[model samples]
Target: MNTRSGLFAVAVGALTALGLACGGAESVDELPPEPPENEVNFPALVQGVVNGWTINTSEEFPPIGCGAGSLINQMRCVGGNCDDVGAYCASAGATFSDTYWTSYFSEEGTNYRTCSAGWWMTGLVCRGAHCDDISIQCTQVTNRGTGSCRWADRQFSEEFPNTYSLPSGWYARGLACTGGLCDNLRVYECQLL
Candidate 1:
């Protein structure tokens, strides 16, 4: 190989070794920008680690709740029928972590559930009736300051650039869906960060 080609190969190898290659690992630029510090809700979700909970895939939702030390962050429907509800648990005071898709093939067929640490389940972006192509939007939370927030019943939608954003004085907490197909994306709201 030419000298220039050899040097290019060495550079590529070095980048791959350091997890900087195209698909090796995400670099800083690939990561979502950090949300404003004062913003109680965030859309910067990453893939979260599984906490080893047996996800229910039945027609009814299993009694899945956040652990004692963890807070309810992301809430959405999962399981084969989408009849089951699940929530992501985050350690208290955690700003935001990552989310992962847990898949299961039950009697109803293939299904998935989204989980994350310290995330505020925003909403889902689906393609059609099957809703298989699910994109979850979430907002993370933390208890850095001394203030309380409440869940509001008001609804909002596709407002922000990528996902939903709340109006002034409102924030997102989690999401809720109804019916077997989860055709609707309901935004859970909160006020006063």
Candidate 2:
């Protein structure tokens, strides 16, 4: 055969030997399938109504995340002899994150921090504090909220202690103190998403 025809014969022979000639290639059905286009990646809810807040008297508890549905949006303090810290949670449907310190002004004032719309009051942290000082520990889902939610008119203290369970959707969200010890507490609830 001519040189060009000889090369073609060798090429065809190699392809035939390797089972890659013409229809010898793999069919569409025989090929591996492609991966999924849109995978579901979402955080799970901590099931049941359970309390996640704790009182750590010695040192600062690291900033914890919402292990479930919403995201911790803000940490705020209401003034007493010491400040009480409250957290605002927002829905995971949107991007939101922030941390700030609010000054303790007076005993008569009950500073409040509220969750935004479509967000739930998940839980809170109550650590020992000096004047205007807050040591936070954002932990678990201590209680489940229900019905229409709103802030309570009074707070927990030495006289009006948190002796009873939170009313309906109400939750203990903040803690005020004296002499670096937790004494007073605050409550509120929001529509959980």
Find the candidate with the highest lDDT and give its number.
Answer: 1
Q: For each candidate, how many residue pairs have backbone atoms clashing (under 3 Å)? A: 6, 4
Query: Where does candidate 2 stray beyond 4 Å?
Result: 1-59, 63-66, 69-110, 123-128, 131-147, 169-183, 191-193
Residue by residue across 95-162, what tens digits does model 2's lDDT show? 22322212221223332333322233444433334223332222223243324544444555434443
lDDT for model 2 comes to 0.34
TM-score of 2: 0.34
TM-score for each candidate, following the candidate numbering: 0.29, 0.34
Model 1 agreement with the true structure over 97-166: per-residue lDDT tens digits: 4332222111122232222333444333343344423334443345432232333343222221212334
Clashes of 2: 4
Model 2: pairs clashing at backbone N, Cα or C within 3 Å: 50-141, 50-142, 51-142, 52-140
Q: Alpha-carbon error at 186 in model 1, in Å?
A: 2.0
Candidate number with greatest TM-score: 2
Query: Which residue pairs clash within candidate 1?
Result: 46-98, 46-99, 47-99, 48-98, 48-99, 120-139
